[model samples]
Target: MSRTTALDPLFTAVDTAAFTDRHLANLAAGTLAAVRVPDFLGNAACRAALSALDRLPTTDYDPGRVPTPIVRFGPALNDYRDQDGHLDAERYWRDAEAARVAWHRAALRPDPIAVSMGHLSAAWGAALAPATINGRAVFGGTLREINAGALIHYDDINREYPTGLFDQEVIAQLAFNVWVAVPPTGGATTVWRHRWEPADDHHRQAYGYRSETVEHCQHVTLTPKLGDGLLFNPANFHAVEPNPDGRRIAFAFFLGLTTTGQLITWS
Candidate 1:
């Protein structure tokens, strides 16, 4: 008798309704909400990309200093700083350049996508016209860029948990995260949480930002399989699980968008 192998979940078609109820409930409870785009990349392309990514190098560094700091983007236009406050464009540029170099070296991929000068220019224009945040004038710009050869996670030997949140808070401005999964023995990225509870002792004693308010956090597993991709809200708690098989490779792209208003284009 011939044995039949069970198919991997990665190759199965995920039910879109799987998390619909959970997503809506979270949004209503003021925790967080998310949407997913299945089959984000075609099967063949996803496989090819993952195969390429496997060959890249993975370097370690302090996540704090990476991608530049939020403060460097300049005070929120609504911040208490004076109109003529000292703005250090040079410093910001230097930091950005350093980040780019470090990112490229770690991934061993040349020509990663970046926030173009056009993006900066658009930001400057937006800054000139004060926008409101928390009922105060604010200057804010969002930019999205790609990291072709990016290591999504690293197994931290020093920590009790094998995983690390290498890309947290640092890239908050990028509201969306996209990962393309390639196949044939690729491991999935895992996202984790402490099983969020609103009534825990830890939740009750918190001040400023409270984890209690956070409904739940999740760990994502990006398994290598043709036509697999994930998109999620980054402000929420999340992490990527290490690819165990070493066959999984991915290209992650960060996306940003304005916080206010709707677009209307007439033809």
Candidate 2:
């Protein structure tokens, strides 16, 4: 992974109390903003999706082998990076059949789960009208959750571009997840006012980055309710708190924003 020295301008002058289009500009500078939209995903649709997901098969993704069921998607990713960024394709496509079926089942339904992930990515990109990538989204991510909770980390990926898109065309990627199921306790996402610049290189390793790098930075942790859709730049340092006694499930995907503002996505 590499860091870009050029910093985008942050629009601190704009009012962020509401999540308006203005946040798009702020997002370019790596700012975190959220707005509570009423019925972000129709209540009935959101509930149905959650219920349906519970019945589907899930593959464990935790390195410690916790019972966290996850289905990671994208055009084509190799293998998970080892403890030192080394490639290992051993677990590649282990449960491909089951994952694809589950994804498509919800995608083609009358009241689909937040639309096709690709469609949802495009709709959001079009709404943002990013400078380069316009409505062209890649599809793949995961129904993200953790057994107890996830460790503090940034969701940025450094994968080889076998999907035909080079990294140079994109400036940053955004993350959007619909809150369909949440716990009665902790499951908040905390976005730190920090990006993974080269200075934070020491935190890089397999099993994910450490939280100490941005410990002193300011942060805003969000606990979204059912049907709440959240959009923010995933390039910033962020983390998720634990929900030991409950489940926190979301359809998580990444939105690739090109330097010219085109929108593309993959999980």
lDDT, candidate 2, equals: 0.55
lDDT per residue as tens, model 1, 146-167: 2222222211111211132111
Cα misplacement distance, residue 48 of candidate 2 (Å): 0.6
Question: What total of clashing residue pairs does each candidate reach?
Answer: 19, 19
In candidate 1, position 132 carries an lDDT of 29
**Per-prediction CA RMSD (Å):** 14.2, 6.5
In model 2, the worst 10-residue window by lDDT is: 129-138
lDDT of each: 0.31, 0.55
Q: Show the lowest summed lDDT stretch of 10 residues, model 1.
A: 153-162
Cα error of candidate 1 at position 18, Å: 15
